[model samples]
Target: MEIEGVRTDRLGLLLDQFDQAREMARVRLAGLGDDEYLWEPVPGCWSIRRRDEAVTPRAFGPGEWVLDKGAPDIPASEYAEVVRQAADGMTVAKIADDWSVGVERVEQVLAHTGPPEPDTSPVATIAWRLGHVHSNFEGQWEWTFGERKDPGLLVDFTPSAALALERFWASIDRWRDSVASVTEEQLDTVGFSRYPHSNDAECPYVTVLAGANLEFIHHMAETALLRDLWRTRFTTSG
Candidate 1:
């Protein structure tokens, strides 16, 4: 599992999982049928169903939105149940799609670019990914690197509603250029974050990164799956 021409290491592990997830995502996308909007595997899940919203997923039930967006002033209890349940049923492509670029910004940029394809596609959708990445950012910053922010409900940046993935598609590189600069030390440093979890006296940063890597890939798979499914639906119905 090599990336950017670098031999395998812990980052390789995370990237390997990401690569495997990409393959799984391709398979799942290949399976999607046509004309199946308003459907998610865990249909029992709840979400904010409406246009003009973020692309967050359903957790617990309806009205389960995370109030804070990585800020430490709020209680984790607000989004704890949501995050806890997130660990239960995970998929990489959806996670990737969920890891979208901010819809508004993406859309604004893509308006000139046209074709919303990128929004559902990886690389383009940076909103959810940024949030997901921040999950790492939160840990790396406050705990591992020891920054000074809570990186509040990193998930809330997600919308319970579907997003303009095409526009999202256009925004991928925005983060790529930024994240590409992250160093091993930045990821390994302790005490960058002020969040309770990051600042925990007992826990360490390496472990936090290890776990975050597994999850980051899972959502990537989930996002890819969603887009592939959406593609199937688009082709069959159109």
Candidate 2:
């Protein structure tokens, strides 16, 4: 559990933060049914439908669900804003100290980076979101820590919420185990992850961690909002 060069105590705190985020995701995904999990609020929304379901004309792929379309634009996170305000000066220690609120509460206040692109953006279902997160987690672990030369190996595309959640936590656990062993010098060392899919391969390990944290925070919020929209929109229509 020791991150090589970071003070053991500080590493513990960082891991605790990660654990909080993961738990928040689990809670948000809990108790979803096939109806709720696969419901698409729009005509072209990407979701886990039957394999024979016709692909939305706007979406790019044919599968049990709609996978990614455009290159995912990573945005500055609302959680990062909290970190800034919490520090009031941008120091990591102060930011950590101020991040005591629950992750769910953070989701409520934080907004996503850009306005949605109606034509280009695919409305994702809960099942897709969980699977996507799980895949990203596994990919990062393989290239960042494991022996896999290609980070994309063993990508999963499970179609059920319950099954997707299981894989999500399993992938997350492996990722958590990998980071627990990273050393302080390793955090600053570029190419530590060697993840080829993004710029993280050339960036410092700590930078990769920051990006991963942002992903968990913002994507979870999006899924939660989608669930709310499903309830409101579908209920009114029916």
Candidate 3:
């Protein structure tokens, strides 16, 4: 199959994956109200909050809305599972795949000898998940395709659901554009993406693109699940 004249090669596959993920996200986000967007299913959930209301030790973005992120507190069971996987000779990639997170994130968890600090990795609100996914696209677009300028502390964290959806869509478009513009030579080139968040600088561009597609796929699925939970929160099983 061909997409916009691009053959169904490696690059095409990546783009197709991204397109499908984006469409799923769009459908999942439709008619998302503000209350649902910021709904915290449990206490101490990390989410997009007003600067004054921020609870995390460190919050990113200069806007009135900040994203809460910290060293996630891994549950004892989860930590043990990682150890068990490692003992079973599972590669980092396999462990990461099982956890549905990036290898680097999995490595970080594995590097720790004990559980993380308390009040960390709280259940995240839909807003928080959307913010995280949007940030990845925005940051990668800035470093990879746009001027290799650092976005600095100027992240546009939107507190309103409507505005957040708008920004998220724009970011997706930018990321898709960047991926679509890559040439075969560029895909094989090292350091094709100057994205500072990961090992993109050391790996081939194709590796970076594939990793990003995985990120989008997993996060969007997670966000969709959150929406489902929100919709069914008040339902009775009887």
Candidate No. with top TM-score? 3
Query: C-alpha displacement of 236 in model 3, angstroms?
Result: 1.1
How many residue pairs clash in all the candidates, one count each? Answer: 62, 2, 0
Q: Is candidate 1 or candidate 3 better by TM-score?
A: 3
lDDT of each: 0.38, 0.64, 0.80
lDDT of 1 by residue, 165-215 (tens): 322222322322333355667446553323454322322434454555565
Q: Each model's TM-score?
A: 0.37, 0.67, 0.78
**Model 1 ranges with Cα > 4 A deviation:** 1-6, 19-37, 40-43, 50-179, 193-205, 220-238
On the 0 to 100 scale, the lDDT of residue 114 in model 1 is 31
Error of 3 at 172 (Å): 0.6
Q: Write the per-residue lDDT of candidate 2 for residues 187-229, one digit (tens) a residue.
A: 8888887765555655678878878887877789898897777
What's model 2's overall lDDT?
0.64
Per-candidate RMSD, Å: 15.8, 10.7, 6.5
Decide which is better by lDDT, 1 or 3: 3
Please report the TM-score between candidate 3 and the true structure: 0.78
